[model samples]
Target: MQDCRILITRPEPENTLTCERLNTHGWSAVPLPMMEIFPLKDTNKKAVIRAQIFDIDTFDYVIFVSKNAARLACDWLDECWPMLPANVHWIGIGQGTTQTLLNEGVPALSNPGHTTETLLDWLKPARMRDQKILIIRGEGGRPELGNKLEERGAKVSYLSLYERKKPQYSAQTFFMLPDINLIWITSGESLLNLSEYVSLHKPEWKVLPVLTPSIRVAQQAKKMGWINASCANGADDNSMIKATEFHIGKQND
Candidate 1:
């Protein structure tokens, strides 16, 4: 392996662990986070908390979009209500979020695909109709999941747990280095941020294959005229490694 370098564009814990996993699998992995998440200001989030305080038991299900959402929402839950309602079902978007719930001594419903569209697909036809669902998420996440829930006759309420913003451009991200073998994008927003950050630096380069988990991210990159972008079918560490191996082989030709 002639240093098949890959860059991971996910944030914080996800990026760090993803890089470690790639290294374990015999790839030179570099973490280049394009977005940073910060807990929402307490004062700003209090209103949303207050609104949901009374109707907490009215919700049939509580959904978590990310681990951060699950952690933050549970923290507040511990403070407001001594114990969770015994009958309320908990749903998580993926393995990561589901694990968070599991750690809290609950086995939550895990959606097959991590994306909102797939999550909605998994919830529809049977579970969503007449369900009172409360979505625990960050400020300004994709509205598709909530909108789909509403359209499917679910009474959906969103509980904002935190916020995320574009990370400041890292000077290290621009320094001339060997062309990357594969660039991994874990989030659609991070992919967009990576493009904007690269555009600001205006790195002189030809074309490099970019791998992302979502079609939406690939489309965004395509709009920027980045032709060598593709979506990975399986959204996991194994799938990312497989995609990287495939692209590296193509690049060698």
Candidate 2:
């Protein structure tokens, strides 16, 4: 693991932190962000997003899909809402999102598990009849979460605060691609974008070892023809680091 050069494909800011952590642990982590997160600039949409944050207390439950969602939504929440409503049940997809909420002075509930399916399972027994649910997330994410909640009789609404876009890679970065020993991908969209970029720029590197945070992401990589894809325990930095070390150990063995 110390000698391995890991390619991190998370979006910027987050990628910087992950790379720093990986470097602190002895791995040479190179950031090759596959996606970029940008807040919505449209005034109309921004107003709606702000209004949703301001009126979050009206909802019975508020769910955050990712740390980005939690952080970005909290920015507007902090501006509009002086105090958070105590009665609203705050649900986060995983520990990372939960911690982000806590850091923003918003306490939340989250399962140890990190997937949308897992969150749905945790909420299955709860009474959802006509309950108003607000989900804060980036634009154009999976609809399964909202769909499942609606099926359980919850009136689901989404507040898209940010959007994800593919990053523009430099020629120097492409030149260094062959040196990458492993790639860490956090989202299905990032994996897809990486695969597409490789297909166009460096197809032979498709055999590179790729680590994903969830089985669904691994499956998506496989479907994209990446045979070396594997799943980590969860999406957190520690989980990804441990999984990378385990994969490297197995390779050495």
lDDT of 2 by residue, 5-65 (tens): 9989888788898899888889898888898999999999988887777788999999999
Tens digit per residue, CA lDDT, model 1, 107-215: 5888788677787778665667888988888889888888888888899888886778888866665776456766887777887788887776644421667887778
How far off is residue 110 in model 2, in Å? 1.0
Clashing pairs in 1: none
Count of clashing pairs, candidate 2: 0
State which candidate has the highest lDDT.
2
Evaluated at residue 204, the lDDT of candidate 2 is 76
Candidate 1 segments exceeding 4 Å error: 50-55, 78-83, 170-173, 176-178, 202-206, 249-253
TM-score of each: 0.86, 0.96
- Give the 10-residue window scoring lowest on summed lDDT in candidate 1: 199-208
RMSD of 1: 2.7
Q: Which stretches of candidate 2 lie over 4 Å from their true place?
A: 170-172
Candidate number with greatest TM-score: 2
